[model samples]
Target: MSLFKKFPFKDKPSTAAITCIHILDEKKTILYVSHDADDGCWQFLCGKEHNIEDSRVVSLQQIYEIDKSIKKIANLEYGKCAYRKYKNSKWNVQ
Candidate 1:
């Protein structure tokens, strides 16, 4: 039997996971993560949406949650895929 068959997998609709990196004039970058809400998980400013524009909106929301003073420097789309797992811990980008 294939190893893939050993574990149950459910096919679900995929959503685009948007991430934004805020650049500062001081040559410092800010990556936002909700420590209180996310339980100390480190991640970039991110959200889920169906399209690039919608994803940008979601990313804006995420950014505001961290700091309203931070303006958007740029936006980039990483396409759509399942959440990457980190061993038995929290999810991470692959």
Candidate 2:
């Protein structure tokens, strides 16, 4: 059996999502996940204050690879977001 299950995000693996350099640098795990209603774009954030220039656009697959826990909210609806207190914490939907 496959070790990882595929998520049904609206975008493809190659599709881009907004993220922080901290996540890409492995400095922090994603603490906030947002699915945009206007464009269906996703955002994986570290839940910290970062400069606008610190934002980066990375593929959805890349973000998934970074934090598999996000898969729990893969079915999150548009305009919705999920957050957690820590890496292993339960996601709180908003």
Candidate 3:
């Protein structure tokens, strides 16, 4: 099988990931993104479930579009909307 055939987001048995969600109304959404203590750029939603309800699966499954590989796309879109709003100081420019 081709290397690309592997699921991008599948965590290996040794690697632990926590997944979360980011809900956006206008822009600058509530990103359930995480960061390591040292480097902060590689942020991602926590990807593991501790329990049924006490988990972020609800949010993850609700994302509109995009695949897990570029999950951050949604977050970035929200951030862009937020920036536009903040820059213009309004959700609608009128």
Ranking by TM-score: 2, 3, 1
Q: Residue-wise lDDT of candidate 2 within 1-94, one digit each (tens)?
A: 4323365455678888999998888679899999999999999999999899999998898888888788899889999999999999999999
Better of 2 and 3 by TM-score: 2
> What does the lDDT read for residue 16 in candidate 3?
34
After superposing candidate 1 on the true structure, give the runs of residues whose Cα lies further than 4 Å from its correct spot.
Answer: 1-17, 20-58, 72-94
Model 1: per-residue Cα lDDT over 1-94, one tens digit each: 9633332212111222234432222222333333222322223342322243322223333433344332221122233122322212333322
Runs off by more than 4 Å, candidate 3: 4-14, 20-30, 38-53, 56-66, 69-94
Return the number of clashes found in candidate 1.
0
How high is the CA lDDT of each candidate model? 0.29, 0.88, 0.31
Rank ordering of all candidates by lDDT, starting from the highest: 2, 3, 1
Candidate 1, residue 15: how far the Cα is off, in Å: 13
In candidate 2, position 56 carries an lDDT of 98
Candidate 1 vs candidate 3: the lDDT winner is: 3
lDDT of 3 by residue, 1-94 (tens): 8533333323222233333332222223333344233432223332233343433332233332222334323233222321122222322211
